[model samples]
Target: MNKHCCNDMTYHANFKCDIHKDLFECPDKLIFFHERDNDYGLIIHDGGSSSIEILFCPWCGKKL
Candidate 1:
């Protein structure tokens, strides 16, 4: 398996750090998001436990 380093790949798959460079606090489940109705906020569900993280959220709370 080829695990990429945090400093290697950009959050939004970019060649370099852009908007989320300095302020990019990349979480384990951080990913891109695109939706309708502007469904903001989050929903907390039971996702078990882990040493890393088990939560999921849209990038920047759907800000992306």
Candidate 2:
């Protein structure tokens, strides 16, 4: 796993199960955090460029 910081940081993940295997298998949701202050932001799965749909977190799996 790798971490990157910028104006903002986003979480990325991928999934592959007996379910939605037709998905991008990439980050369905991203939890952006500012290491500078430990401030966190939530980005709900909206099905867009920065959209998230899966319930898995490659960063920190937490009921997303």
The top-ranked prediction according to TM-score is 2
- Which 10-residue window in model 2 sums to the lowest lDDT? 6-15
After superposition on all C-alphas, the RMSD of every candidate to the true structure, in Å, is 13.4, 10.2
Question: Residues 30-51, candidate 2, lDDT per residue (tens digit)?
Answer: 5543356544444444554343
User: How far is 43's C-alpha from truth in model 2 (Å)?
Assistant: 1.9
Off by over 4 Å in 2: 1-27, 44-64
lDDT (C-alpha, whole model) for all candidates = 0.28, 0.39
Q: What would you estimate as the lDDT of candidate 2?
A: 0.39
Q: What local lDDT does model 2 show for residue 17?
A: 35
- The TM-score of predicted model 2 comes to 0.26
What pairs collide in candidate 1?
none
TM for every model, in the order presented, reads 0.19, 0.26
